[model samples]
Structures are given as structure tokens and as C-alpha cells.
Target: MKNTSQSETISIIGAGLVGSLLAVLLAKRGYQVEVYERRPDMRKNTISAGRSINLALANRGIYPLQQAGLMEKVTPILTAMKGRMVHDLEGKQNFQSYGQKVEEVIYSVSRGQLNKICMDAAEETGLVNIHFNQKCESVNFIDKTMTLTDELSNESRQVTFEHIIGTDGSTSAVRDAIHQVNSSQHDIIPLGHSYKELRIPPGKNGEFLIDKNALHIWPRGGYMLIALPNEDASFTVTLFMPNQGEISFENFDTPEKVKDFFKRYFSNVVPLIPDLSQDFFNNPTGKLATIKCSPWHYQDKALILGDAAHAVVPFHGQGMNCGFEDALNLVETIDKYPNDWQTIFSEVEKNRKINGDAIADMAIENYITMRDSVRDEKFLLRNALAFELENRFPDYFCPRYSMVMFHRLPYAEAKSRGSIQEEILMQLTDSARALDDINYSIAEKLIKQKLSRVQLNPN
Candidate 1:
């Protein structure tokens, strides 16, 4: 093997957020990084425009950006959101703070903007080259060669590299190639839920139509509509519903039906969204799913990260955050074994497989909680009690949502602790009328006994 210190030429498939950030990270470590994107560069041309998924940037995701020294520039684009602003069927609104303190809030950021920032950061390193309009058509992982197609000209080119990283997202072409080689261990599980995007335009004078600092949700029994504020004073609205069934996306045959459905269920939103009909008809509906793949790396030649390895439903708003964590985790693993690709790949797969699956499952569970449980009185009580416990026992208790969102806790740990915390909440709140009804003595005793202290290491 060549000296571990020798510069390794790394081919990165997909120039999206994860791929771009990985490029910056590796390039800073003196690796020659080649990044390829299938689409026209959004930094130059318009891409995804209105249909882009606006991201919820939390602590886990922010830590990675800070590590890359990109937060100094990226933080300016973020809009702080401290909690959920739930609007009822009657249009009555309520605020639910995400955390007890002032700094415990997520930021709303445009996905395209964040991607462009990472891409720019990578290119500025001079060691990274981002080839726009170049798509990875297929890969010969055995020989470590890849065929890249020019999307604009439909021309193909082949490149050889000892190492390849696939962050091309859930529908990854490189991953497909890996699947062709070994199909037994790779699977994409579909979530029955699908989502459609709508926009709530800014009011006159660029004023926000609703509260500007919170994530707004309209939770019905079976499905829900959520709106996250954007920097341009507009809000990105998403409707999550089943693909089939009476109350699903399949049932809304016409724009009129959609409007009527909205008027009946989300009546207040009718006036708030003036272009609701046009948007309902014009915008595309997207499917939600999770990808489960074992051995994320193939013999040290190729590896997959982010949505490619484990795509989760976006209910918990951790899909991007988890992907960011993947980048950080891999970077740390690489630091541990700077020159050993085989060891790096194996350790990454070992370290992340369970955490990835755990977050995916938790994201799915959160979908139900967001759409149905958010409005439930029992759910509210449990949430309140959970927050109370966190307030009382800062070291021993952290609400599952807070742990996942506010702290850098591992997803598997959060999910495990969350399950226990959830059971305790169910037991205490199952019959209690409200917070006053729950016995603090028994609750604190159970928490201290069942849950260990959450030690947050300083970053």
C-alpha cells in the first residue's frame, strides 16, 4: 500500500449537502476530492425553486457546519425557531416551546442555500473540484472505476479512483450498482405517507402572514399540514397524507376538492393561502421512505452516506441533521485511521448502521406523533411532564425531542432513552388529568431509577 500520508484521490458522487460537506472536510485534510452532480448547478441556475424541501437546522447539523468553519457564514441565513405554533381547526393558536432555555432552538434554512454554501466552501479549498452536470451512471467497484455521464450532452466519461463516496441520496446510482453486485443486504422501505408542498406568501410589505419565529402545524386526526417560515417572509407549507385511502393523496382528484378539504379541515388557512388552489394543482407530491443497507462500504473502494444508506421520513426534521452527523462521524473515524481505507470503512459501517436505522425508525414514529399526537390532550400532558422532568433533573433527564434536537446525543441513545422515558410518561399520564395530577415523587423516582444521567460533553 502507498504511504498513508500520500494524497488519495477521492471521487465523491453527488454534490448535494452531504457530498459537498464531505468534499470540504476531506479536502481540508489534503485529499484530492472530485465531486460530481447530475443536475445543473443551483449556484448558477435555478433548481428545485419552490419545490425544495426547506430544512430544519438543529444542534446535530449545526455542530458539523461549525466544525467545517462554515457556520460563521451560514448562521446569517438561518431564522431561529424556538417552538411549534399549532393552529387548531378553529384557528386558535398555541405555542409550545421546544426547550426550556433561550438557546435551545432550531433554525429554518433553505436547502438550496445550504447546499450552495457547502459547494462554495469545498471549491474554495482549491483541492476540491466540483463537476456540475456530471452524473454517476454506473460504477465498477471492483476495479474502483466509475462512468460519469454529461447530463447536458448525454456524453459519457470514465474515471479511475482508489476511493469513492456515494452521497447521491436515497435514489443513488452508485448504490444501485452496489445493489446489483449484492442485492441481499440492501432494501428501500417505503412509508405509506406522501407530502405535497404549498407556499404561504408574505403579506404586504414583506411581512409574515403568521408568527415569524415558530414552526406552524395544523394537525388533524389522520394527516397534518405544517408550515416552516422562510427567510423571504414566505412559509413553506407541507401536507403529509397517505398515498391511498379516503383521506389520502389519491382521494383529492381536483383542485376544488383540495380547497374544500382545506376549508373544512384547515378553514383559517384558506384566507392565509391565496394561491392555495393553484399550488395544490401545480406542485408535485413527494413520497416518503427509508433505506436500509448493511455494510455501507464495499471492500474499501466505495462507501455510501446520508440518505443513500438510510433515508428517513422527515417527520422529526432530523433527516438532514442525521446525515450531517454521518459526515462528522466518518470524519472522526478517518482521523482515527488516516490512511487505512479498509479500517475506516469497516469502522464507519459498524458505528453508524444501528444509529442510522434507529433514527429512521424514530423519524417514522415521529410522523404519527406530529400528525395525530400533537393535538391529543394525553400527548400534551406527556410532553409537559417530559419537559418538567428535564427541568428538574437536568443531568438525569432530557426530553427525547430535546435530546435529539437540542443536544449532540447519539440517535440510538436518544431512541433507547426515549423509549424508556415514553413508557414512564405513559404510565404516569395514562390516568392523570394534567401536570398537577401526576405524582412528582413517583415520577422522579422512576426516572432516576430507570434513566442514567445525560452527560453532554463540551464541543
Candidate 2:
């Protein structure tokens, strides 16, 4: 099935979501592909319990799945999360819609299920071969070779390739090799916050304890706890806080302190989890970070995609979506320049690098919005006003969140326009509590003057 006239084949590292998806995408293009995964076959083994077992899939990710002809396979495993259901300290709940329309909602998906489906699809093509428990040891772009150590046999094998793509996640061995060659190429910046996972099982009748259609959050100033529903009527709960602070993970060392901490802030959640203290102490605490690297491709010999190139925090729910977009972008770019590897790599890297950085920065900003601003009165007012402005100036105005989640607008463009939108909102909300008190004439005039317009979206 190899389309190229040359003898060289494409090799991929990491069989996680991005790796499997990339392998399928490349195989579909008639390139013989082989993948190496560090972990055991996830389909046959139970996934390790850790933070963020599920992922939020938005339009950016869906576009790629649709491209791979996987939406039908993936749709059944997904549960729609229309918006953020914010819970107050007293257990009061409020729903905030994520998008303007019904069809604009994001989805909650299990990581293990999605990875298995992708790998299955790749292998079903018969153009891809995946070797499990083969840990990537090193990648030599100069020699066009990659050495993978067999976990079972403790043997190393060097595989040669005409081209290589590293879709390995954060702590990527492929990326580490690139760093060794070029020390100043990348930096992994920690966000100083960590997260721990807690589970909320379903009721006796298999009913969801909370509204299953929404992503739930308990936003405290500087810290928060979030939950997303799973198919089994259960929820995967996560507690995010500073690594070292007045009321951080450090302070929740003892069982008594963990109990009291949940009682103080997540009082309503304490009763939902029978083994709160046990889960809190037993589960691992995971760190959040952004991996910013340059020159995604090492000449034409090797390239890095997904988390290997840019790893953003999960605050905006775009981490997986962005990585999926990377896979789609590279495949399409390669399609355009099939015979020219350098051009394909350069074009993809040039186009995706800014968007990658843009999403990373936006994810950090959204963490602040999620933890503190979601519950603020002014923040709510501005959020409502942003939608109002979008209603009036539909072409010119779209909330940054909507742009990032619901629309295909480039992330860099969204971030740039969002800064301008923020200034306008600040001026319009100056000393005003609600939209009724504002001057519509002045608002319309200022919007027209400062913001350009196009044909409105009928939807």
C-alpha cells in the first residue's frame, strides 16, 4: 500500500491518542506506518488511575475525527456537556451555556476508549503496525534511525525511516532527543498548580448524582474542583490547587485535614464520595505545564506533533483538540506537498506554531477565568454582555471562548481579537452594573467605528 516510489517508510513514536490518530491518518494516505508505544496495550489492560482520565472534545478535535471518518465510532462513547454548571459554596448550582446554539456543545470522552478506537482503526487499514511495550530510547535525525527498547525482552532495535513523527506526550523521549541535540530548543514551564483525581459513583438506580449534560465546577478564588460525567453514570472529579499555598495539597497531608478541607470548600461533594479521604491520599497528584518548543521538524528527517511540540494546560478543554488539529494539519499539509518533505514540514510548522502558542497562553488565561472569574458578578455581567454584543454585531463580535471552542477561527486571530473585545467590554461596563444602563447608541457607534463588520451568520 506504499504510495511513494522510495523504499523508506514513515515511523511514528507513541501509541497514545495523537500517535494512533496520526498513524491512521498517514496510513490512509497510503504510507506504510509503524508505531512504538511505551506502555502495555491499553485495550487489554486496565488504565492506570490518575488525574484527567477523560477529555473534553470540542469542534477543533471533532474536525479531525470527522476527517478520519471516526465521528460515528466516537459519538456513541461521548456524552454531551453543554456548558459549565457552576456550584456555589452552599451547593447552589447555575448553568452557563458554552455556545450560542444547541449544536455548539462540547463532548466528554474517555481517554482509554478513544485511544483504543483509533489504534483499532489504524490496524484495520492493514497499512499500520503497532508494537506495544517498546519504549523509545533515542531518535537520530542525522542517521535517520530510532532506537526502541523492548520492555519485555530488554533488547534494543533500531528502525530506519524516510520520515519520523513524534506524537509522544509530555516527557516525550523523542522530544528529549531533540533537546539533547539543540539545548535551547524547548522549555517545559510549570504552572505551579497540581491536580488530584476523585471519583463520584452513580446512584443505586444508575442515575447521575448531578446534571450529566454539563461540566460541573466548584470555583473558589485561586483554586477549584471540577467534574465531568462518564457513560456509567459516574463522574470523574478533579481538585486543582496550588502546589504550595495556605490551603494547597501541602496542607492536606493528613486524613483529618483532607476531610476538613473537603468539608470547608466542597461540602456537598464530600457525601457523594464514600472514600473521599482514601481517594485523596491514595491517588497521585499531577502537575500542569505548557511545553513550548521551536522548529517542530528537525529538517526533513523527523518532526514532532501533538504534545511533543506544544503541550497546553487542560483549563480551556482544548489540549486534546489542539493535538488532533496538529495531526490533521500535518496530513493535509503533506497531501499538498507529497513529494517535498521539507516544504510539507515547513508549511505545517509555520502555520501551527503560532496557533499552538496562542492556545497555550489562552489555556492559562482560562484557568484564572475558571477558578475565580466564573463566580464573580462582574465576570458574569461581562460574559453576558459579550454574547449580547455578538447578537448585535454578529459578524464583528464573537466571544473568545466561542472562537476557541465552537468556531474554526485560528487561535492567534481569536486571541488578537479577544484583546480588542476585552477593551470594548471594559469601556462599556465602566461603572455600569447591567446592560440596561448602557447607552446602545454609543455602543453601536463605537462598535462600528472600532470593529469591522461582515455578513452576519444566519445561524
Best-performing candidate as measured by TM-score: 1
TM-score of each: 0.96, 0.96
Q: How close to the true structure is residue 369 of candidate 1, measured as C-alpha lDDT?
A: 83
lDDT (Cα atoms) of all candidates against the true structure: 0.87, 0.87
Q: For candidate 2, write residues 355-377 as lDDT tens digits.
A: 99999999999999998899988
Question: What TM-score should be assigned to candidate 2?
Answer: 0.96
Q: On residues 30-65, what C-alpha lDDT tens digit does candidate 1 reach at each position?
A: 778888888888988977832356889999999989
Off by over 4 Å in 2: 1-8, 49-51, 453-459
Which pairs in model 1 have colliding backbones?
none
Q: Give the RMSD in angstroms, all C-alphas superposed, for model 1.
A: 2.1
RMSD of each: 2.1, 2.3
